[model samples]
Target: MGAMDVVLVHGIFDNGAVFRRLADALADAGHRCWVPALKPADGRTGIEDLVAKLHAYIDRHLGSDAEVALVGFRMGCIVSRYYLQMRDGVRRTKALNVATGPDPEVGDAPKPTLSTSGC
Candidate 1:
């Protein structure tokens, strides 16, 4: 397929830099990708804050009629879900991709619960 615009979201305790390799690959394949760093990324950011950041990024960067796809990794999935469902996202969203993985530990990580719905 031809080049497409995309946003790559990082997981908790991680920053946008983590997507460097994947971003390079996407660039090589002719896709425009952005890996924006979200605040409180060290597994302590509240879900609401992350959601707000995502919404602001889209509002400020994307055009009114722009069609873009979302690719959220791990905790990012939850952020994307909330954005699409509660922020009038379907109008501009072309596709949504979410990647989830099993938690490696529950040891000292903050235990936060989340519930979301989206198309």
Candidate 2:
């Protein structure tokens, strides 16, 4: 595919700096990458709050109409999922790449089906 707008999300206990190398590589490859540092990385503020912050970040930086590819690591995967499933993100998300650890929120839950054919 051509150059895409990509958002890289860091895990709990980490910040956007963690994706510096990956962002550099993606940028060098002509992709527009945004690595946002979600505050309260410890997650004491809750995942929904983090998702809200992510939503605002995307709105501010990428606009609501831009199609984006999401890359999430560890706890960020969970945040990304919430954004996709509950925040209308599937409408504008071109792809999702999740590198996640064990997630209690997903354990034993039915898998969600996301339609991206029109994205």
Candidate 3:
């Protein structure tokens, strides 16, 4: 298989430097890893801005043919999930490796349909 592209998105109050070990390991294994620092912002505005930033970073670095993976913590998971929902063709991203909230109650709350291929 070709080299895989991995995108590491840090959680609130944290920065991309948090992924140094993981990024180093992935790169050692021949995969391309990215952990661009999410630009600082206020609580409310940061979410969407971070998501857009991640999306743009992925597009600029990985291109269309590369597989994209996300690693986020806490509120970062929500941001990553929201981005995954809106992004097309790029299905199956990894979540929960970092801290996150309770798993959604599928029936009680609206849930997005994720493709059953990759994670």
Candidate 4:
């Protein structure tokens, strides 16, 4: 496959830097990766804020490039789900929820309950 641009969004308590290894691996496989830094500071930001931030970032960086995919971890996955509900132009997007669940605002999607089984 040819090179395609990728956008990686990290979960709470972590930044885009968290995806460095994964992005590198993808790059090695001939795909361009973009792991934008979302706010990692605790209590200062929330998932809604992140969704807006990521949307703007994708618009700015990818800009009409539909050959893009997303890798969202944990809370990032929630953001991606909402984005997917809202985003209409992107051609491809993959959401990887490392340890997470549906967005609270998604309503009726069954908010996930925490357990030892993992987030």
lDDT of 4 by residue, 1-119 (tens): 35667777777788877788887888888888888877643426766677777878888887855556666677676666656665542344532233364446766432323211111
Off by over 4 Å in 2: 103-105, 108-110, 115-119
Using TM-score as the measure, name the better of candidate 2 and candidate 3.
Answer: 2
Tell me, by lDDT, which candidate is best.
2
Error of model 4, residue 94, in angstroms: 7.1
Off by over 4 Å in 4: 40-44, 89-119
lDDT of 3 at 43: 43
Please write out the lDDT profile of model 3 over residues 6-35, one tens digit for every residue: 677777777877778988988898877788
TM-score of each: 0.77, 0.88, 0.72, 0.70
**Residue-by-residue lDDT tens digits, candidate 1, 27-118:** 88887887778888865767778888887887778765677677788878667766676666666777677677335253333322322222
Sort by lDDT, best first: what order? 2, 1, 4, 3
The residue-by-residue lDDT of candidate 2 on 9-29, one tens digit each, is 899999999899988999999
* Regions of candidate 1 where Cα sits further than 4 Å from its true position: 43-45, 101-119
* TM-score, cand. 4 vs. native: 0.70
* True-structure RMSD for candidate 2: 3.2
- Candidate 1, residue 41: lDDT: 84
Inter-residue clash pairs, candidate 1: none
